[model samples]
Target: MTLRIATAGKGGVGKTTFTAMMTRALVEKGARPALVVDADPNANLNYYLGVKYDATVSDLRESLKRDQPPSGMSKPDFTALKISEILSENDGYDLLAMGRPEGPGCYCFVNEVLRAAMTRLASKYAVLLVDNEAGLEHLSRRTTDDVDNLFIVSDSSIVALRAAARIKLLSASLELKVKNISLVLNRIKSDAEREAAISSARDIVGKDTQIAAVIPEIAEIGGMLSSGSNVFLLKDFPREILEPLVSPHET
Candidate 1:
């Protein structure tokens, strides 16, 4: 099964971490190769994945906007070259970084082409995980709609629920082709906290969607920030949570 998962939510809510961890786990579970599109402008996924790319989608878009690469290359040729250069392969998955523009206003054409190319590329992999910007590019509608599973990651804060509700509405307005709009409540400390987090998410989803997983707050994860050692081996947490979210479809 080809599952495209889009992880989106407020900034600092562990969206990137969730995306990276889930992708890694899927790889270990004997799934076919997976692809990750780090569409967030911050582009921190690269640092976490420990892969250095030569160019980004933004770099390519800038090349098109600027009308030439630094070496005066054509857009199509530059596109093929940059697409290969920016895709980093490691740990049985490849990461494509959608970088922040070095300078720009909008990336209309490049974004369309990149999305199209990705849609075609999606058929080749077992999964495509997208880590998107936080309402920055208005990309949620397009990115999340095509996914097989779209998780709205949130913290345990009250603000998180409210923001999530808004994001859900925004997603609806964008008319995204969401297969399953699931919520992932992250960073809970205690059982009580976990319950509260799940409850909060339930309220936000409000009779339509459901909480897929509640990830416990792990101190070690914070410590691994600079190392890029994702939660592939997060035995207690990742598997505990993700197995349920995806288990039914596994068989």
Candidate 2:
């Protein structure tokens, strides 16, 4: 079974960094060949994962409007083939980026094709980690629905917590098939802040949601992000912060 894990948070809240760390943790735990989907329009998950991608699903969709596949090939087959070509394969995982959102034109047909292709590709992996946008448009589109675990990340700020609460509410309103939804309080500065953030999160996100992980604010991670360094290079990468998120998927 593919363990579908998604990370959602407002911009600048460290969701991408968390996704990268979680990917490393999953690989270290023997979860090989995971599928990492960059569901954000401003795609950078590949950079954090230390991989480069030339194309994206949205890029293919746009091209399909103007170009045609080889002679005698159907559109669906062509789309699937293009999507497969864009997948950036790596040692422990592969990255698929969903580039910029749709433009003025209708994309119902292309979206359906992309969704189907993504579903087919996901089945070949043991884990699927999606780094989603702030609004979670990917989930709303059903591009990556039926999530096994949804991690709503937030910094130690009231505004960020409010955003997290809204994301949780939106997930419920959309009726997304998420088996477990948790709040990941990230980049905490101190024990007091972590405690306060957890308490505030519990109150805001409600008791139904679990406080899955509280990650401390590590200067090394911040430096790496600022310097565009690979996630694996961060010494003492907080694997403990990800254990809670990874253990459940372990066999």
- Candidate with top TM-score is 2
Clashing residue pair totals per candidate (backbone < 3 A) = 1, 0
lDDT per residue as tens, model 2, 44-79? 898888889988888776587888989999877787
- Candidate 1 on 1-251: residue-level lDDT in tens? 56778877888888888887777667677665888888876788866655667777776665566656557776665665557666788777888887664447665654665575467766677877888777535444264557677788888897877777787877777777776777788898999998777776777656575777888888878867555464654445466566555443732
Q: What lDDT is reached at residue 4 by model 1?
A: 76
TM-score of each model, in listed order: 0.84, 0.89
lDDT of model 2 at position 180? 83
Write down the lDDT that model 2 would get. 0.80
Worst 10 residues of 2 by lDDT: 105-114
What TM-score does candidate 2 get on C-alpha atoms? 0.89
RMSD of each: 3.7, 2.5
Give lDDT for model 1: 0.71
